[model samples]
Target: MTTFRESLARVASRRSFLAVSGLIATAMCRPALAQDAGTPSASGWAMTDGRGNTISLPTRPERVVAFSPVAAALWELGVRPVGVFGPFRQEDGSPDPQIGEVDLDAVVSIGDWEEFDLERLIALDPDLLVGLSLPDVPNTLWYVPEDASATVEAIVPTFGVTPSDRGHLGLIEDIESLAAALAADLDAPGIVATRNEFTAAEAELRDLLAEAEGLTALVISASPDEIYVANPSWFGDLRFFLAAGLPIIEPETEERWEILSWEQAAKYQADLILVDNRGGGVPFPVLDPIGTWQSLPAVQAGQVGPWHAVAPYGRRAFSNIVRELTEIIRQTDASVVA
Candidate 1:
């Protein structure tokens, strides 16, 4: 029953504890051969992660284990992981929205967002572990618990890609680069087609936004008691929307999110409101009846849309999101808010 914010705070606290105890420093001392990209060196195969740590293996990794988002990105590029750890499923046993283009029945689910099964991960005999790295947390992979870090590091070479501040397009490019290194056929017909589709969708969005002036948007995630207003700079998708000329309301805070009580939900008025539609969030149906939520200008005017806040960093996934948003914007009333 732990909230997402509580889980993040726990991870940060655990990381700080590990750093002070010098476990992180000790792990870093382990020897690794350097190689640019996914090139073969005298040692074997090597690639540098987002944090600048070069991981080397005796051979190119065929059995990889990755966080769900990373696995989804690789899946779209035709690289299948042996196992995946993250929020890949909903309570009813359906695929989570964040898991894009990945066949859950085919891959091993090691764990969810809060924890991973170390024994299962070891049994997979993985040669590589891939996940995201947050800019705020150094030397730690996004979902891999800090308490299990040293053990996981000993099991396989780890690679991380930071998503924040890069924008969605930049993140997709990074994933494509990783896919190439992993021996993915970037020139494959499907891959090429998806890329083209993404480009077209981006252009369509840009064109629409060019003509649609005076429209403003607010991106948010909600719980029963509180709402988390996203800071676009920390979210790749939001940053891309902003860069594409979407007038997203910037929260008056430096942190990745501006947490507000439900009573304060109407503090920022926008023509459109994008609510996070990921699993584990309070759904629109549940919030619609709340007096404070119903009082928001966007809600009253019905200018609300779903936000895939953490879609896989793949062309196809993003293309779908962009197309959906484009349609929503096309139907939105810019005069919803004064």
Candidate 2:
């Protein structure tokens, strides 16, 4: 609900990278001493599907593959996927995108999480497949729903990122394990590098984001009521901003948020805001809400910023966008300007 100009005013109040590196941003440094090193096996990772079937894997898997957006984290961590899950635009056709962002062309499609082309997946001959389905989602049927229960024999070694309901963990842990599984030296230590990046950035902004700051935010679309709250779920890509201990303003009763109405925006009195731009609405149902949001308090207070075009969580989504965010936040953080 905040105006761009207004948000600019508070950026100097905040504080805000690199190889064009993906979120993994693996820096060439002394080996981090593998977190999973000398471990009997990956502790946090699983090699079975939801059906109780075990997904087989080669010890040193090189031709890796995945079947969901969540699995893309493997790619960001240096796993060149041979297959992935993406919109095929066809009910019965190949999973091809009229528009591609993350190189869906890298491999074949297993068909969206549901309607998975088992034959297609087998055709790719991937050693591992990351599968998860939100319990409430209709497509829950397709998620490794049974695990290796049905075809435990034919299943490849796969990793379940998290509990079915927790899509966020599925995305984050998948990347972490994918890197560890590959023994990828190029990005093997990336997890530490990323956490370090977040820690350094957060320390610098401690003053600006002082817990007592009590800054409120209403990150709704100016065009519609699409919410972009910094929940652990979707916004994990923006972990740096959230981990910075930046104050959040939301209703006391609510622990998470998806969208807030204009009245809700005015009521919460958020000190900051984020707006999603859908290239005029292709990505978000709402195009721009400047007409309705121009007058919100956060906008009046000048603490709003334009949300990026991609998902702001997980290494897969943030790999390419952190660079842009770095510039935006650096310009806004009051600490940086001072």
Candidate 2 overall lDDT versus native:
0.41
For residues 141-241, what per-residue lDDT tens digits would candidate 1 score against the true structure?
Answer: 86688898999899888888754334566657777887888899999999999989988999999999999879999988776777778777656677779
Identify the leading candidate in terms of TM-score.
1
lDDT of 2 by residue, 183-301 (tens): 64434476557655644544556545563344443444343433334332223333344555644443343332334455554455555566543222222223345444556555554
CA error at residue 308 for candidate 1, angstroms: 1.4
TM-score of each: 0.87, 0.57
Backbone collisions counted per model: 0, 40
In model 1, which runs have C-alpha deviations exceeding 4 angstroms?
1-36, 41-43, 280-282
